[model samples]
Target: MGTSAERTGLPDTEGISALPADVPAWRVLLSYVRPHRGALLAGGVLSLATAASGLVLPLVVRELIDNLGSDGPVAELVAAMAALVLINAAIGALGSYVLHRTAESVVLEARHHLIGRLLRLRLSAVERHEPGDLMSRVTADTTLLRVVTTDSLVGGVTSVLALAATVVMMGLMDLTLLGVTLLALAVAVVVIGLVVPRIHRAARHAQESVGVMGAALERMFGAFRTVKASGAEDREGDRLRGAASEAWRASVRAGKWEAVAGNTGGLAVQAAFIAVLSVGGARVASSAIEVGTLVAFLLYVYYLMPPVNQLASAVTQYQVGAAAVARIQEAEALPIEQLGPLPRATDQPIPSPPPRLQPTGTTSAPAAVTFDRVSFRYDPELPVVHDEISFAIPPGGMTAFVGPSGAGKTTVFSLIERFYEPDTGHVLLDGIDVQAWSLTDLRAAIGYVEQDAPVLSGTLRENLVFGAPGATAEEVERALRTTRLSAMINALPDGLDTTVGHRGMKLSGGERQRVAIARALLRRPRLLLLDEATSQLDAVNEAALRDTIAEAARTTTVLVVAHRLSTVTLAHRIILMDAGQVRAIGTHRELVTNSPLYAELAATQFLATAG
Candidate 1:
């Protein structure tokens, strides 16, 4: 969030730059206010009433001064003064209430629309922009917008009207003095014009700096454990401090410009006051204007200062608001993953189907998933991650992908999940192109458990039902038991209700993996993609997890990216990959005999055990 200093920086400026001629930022902002048009109109009316009431005070002063020699009642004077104060207070309160309520509603609606758009954005788009930058747009930028929506809009209108009314009243008193006042104000307006753009530029930079700082902080905190282990606390602190300092410097620059603008406006008003006094005093002495009229004119002149100052401040506020709007618009403009109108099947139970194995070379129709000569690269300038890869997972069976590190093993899972589109060829599900199916429908049919098994900050029950929101208690228990997590759940202090702590940090590695598997099982997907949990575990835990995998394979089509040789040995068939290509395909024993890379990996592990 922007600091209090940054928020107030613009109100102190002298002149602001003209808005861009090409695109109307203010028009775009006003669209959000359209929904609350009634409240805005009410506020504007109240502001006009307040300005009119304020105008009455100078008139009352003029009357009092003019009729001093007349037989005017002292009681009437007191009553008039009292009425003026009461009217001002009542109108002020009404304007305040209306402006505040409307501003809150505008902010609420903006946040809702921004969040909805963000959620719909494609995974690729989200990956392109840092999460912390996105968060700043929603949280910090919206706060800056509130200033314009409430104070700037209401105060600006009232200020302009009051200034106009005061000027006309001054003209009525004495045109010569009014002309002098106008000259001084014109100079002030020109000076303010020069300053407003500087303030806006500074404000935009300050906002950008804030987003940079947020991204830096998120990166540091996200890899907290890694930083600690690497003993890089001081280094991380320095990086964060640098980001914060940059934000501070940008804020200070913006504040400095605002201060100059505000002081310049004040100087202009003071000059106008001095000019009015000198010229109006001469006119009074010459018998051209009455002393009472001159006195009232001076009072109106003083009142004009606040409105002029407010008008300048409003321009500054607008610049800050515009900076925030730009950031928000950028997020809203991102292309989201297309989700078609597929009927939600949350209420329906997933039917368990018997597992059936089909041969790899069988002339039967393709199964649910087929990678037909697919090739993908995250960066166009870089070599492909998966090159001309063709494979098929039949409707039901256990097929595993095994390879050395950086052999495109995980890329296969990424492709299957549609995290990235293949540059060449295509991926098909049930004869339909993967891209043709809506992302939601395609993902709903497949359950994926990543290697790290991320857990959110919530109770165990919340984590279990995350994948399947409407899963029954009985189904939850069945999933837990199927993954061998029921015994551990019963042993925890709060059982299913136990808080997972941030990212499930409270659970052991094996426990976390089982919890993830249970969550996936709750979805009861036809195809399950398991990136085998490779965290080192005790022999007992390993044996139990192997048994759990075997049991799960009985019902679902299991495609696993295997890291451990022992895990790969259990596969009915293993596809060996290397350097973005599927090098060989066979059972483990056959691979050891036919493929040199497979034999080398097995031998390396064998020798390590023997030693």
Candidate 2:
């Protein structure tokens, strides 16, 4: 849960390392390449052959030039030169194709591992990061690996082979000229080394700034309606624009450093080319070297230019990709949730067992739910949300928790559903410690409907079966009838097949609530937890909703966290809370007389004066 800054691998321009930190970037890059090494090695060998063939082309041309009018067959020399040219072009194309395909395969591998880890990450880990920023890592960051594997890594490799071959050949032709060439290139190397780290820093800053911008945009979109209604569009726009400007500035800075490095490399290689020619020309004039050999050495000098320039470009591209890989590494560093008895992440997928619900049985069993001195806080630094508070709801009855906002009423349901764990005390369900039960089984045994009563973007049938994937058609009809949704479904043009828009925005609040209710009922859960399920409904729908809760309680336990007291006045038992403590627990009529806080809430929130 520490900051990403503490672990992000962006301090240097080196590639991402999947191994331990001591192993270094080269080894890390090799690990990703190792999977596709066969293809990469073939491509690299072919690329080396292409460079070698290119060197031979100049030799063929030099031979043609020296033997133009000689007794030697000129037609055969021209044919040989033509063949080398075609061979160079063909090998270059084939090598590039193989490397490019390998890069794509690497990207797929990285994404699959990243996504699997992301989906299995603990809820707490997910909560600490922004959805949009994480999405940027999954998508934008993964794309950068392609350039790293293909252009930067492979290109650097082939450039080294070409540079080494060219240097060796140049040395053999004229050692003195090669020495001068090396001295000139050394100045460029010093200049490049000085700026490489700066380029890395700039690129990392740019990528991080872009991630911040993405997070800002996600925040704006998530609360778009609120922003418009509050007339805060200008404020929000300025905030997003500020984040964008930061990214732009960092990118421009990175580009400036990259340009400096590229120009330095180009100028150095060009200077070396000129120096080699000047030295070789003088040597040739004094009969120290042959004219044909000088021409071939110059061809080697030209060949040296591309590898040097390519190495420079590759280094710059590598810094950019390294920046992206750093971001991806930060995301992958988090621990994934232990899905079951066995971990979910592996080279081969593990088959997950079906959720086993606790069987509903004899009425003489312990209470369906119990909280023993529970204490919780969303953040350790913040005030406690639940303070050593405890309560129990027996089976087969509607129990309502009526309280003001921030009283931790809704938190109780969250604890039971285990969206989070209590920091200090135990939460039990049907006499079993919840910590001892399987997360899948514990959740499968309870059905939860949030305050918003979220409906997914899918067909009615899909939503109905979401909680209970294996629910039967008869089960669906039974839930619909109980939730009083059968009438609504019959009126729709597509009935159960009707498409619900995003977050079920296509349906009214009442309809969405009913859909959530039906979905929960279809699961045949032993306990139903409803958090302000009727808070947004009109009087008629609220009344219907209360009746529906009552109907559901006939066979199962119903726990209600009520915002409006009238919705749960008829509950078998009422627990009144204030701040994070239960103030009173009894029948509504009993609490009305005993608890002053409950009475105040009834007068101010539950009962407004007659219209």
All models, RMSD in angstroms: 7.6, 6.5
Q: Which candidate is the best by lDDT?
A: 2
RMSD of 1: 7.6
Report the C-alpha displacement of residue 250, candidate 2, in angstroms.
1.6
* lDDT tens digits, residue span 1-611, model 1: 53232455322111122123344667757777776788888998888787788778878877887778575655687689789989889988988788887887777667766776777787778988988899998898878877888656766777787888888888887888889999988998888789888888999899988998899888987878889999999999999899999999999999988888777777888888898888889999999988878888888888887788888788788888888888777777777655652243222233222122233311222136788998888887877788899877666667888777788888787877777777887777665566666677677777888988888889999999998897888789878877678888898889999998877878877788888888887777767888975444456766777676766676667788876666777777889899988999889899999999989977885334323
**Cα lDDT of model 2 by residue, 71-152, tens digit:** 6668998889889899999999999899898898777667766776687777778899998898878787878788888768
**In TM-score terms, which candidate is top?**
1
Residue-level error in angstroms, candidate 2, position 38? 3.0
Q: Candidate 2, 137: how far from true, in Å?
A: 1.3
TM-score of structure candidate 2: 0.86
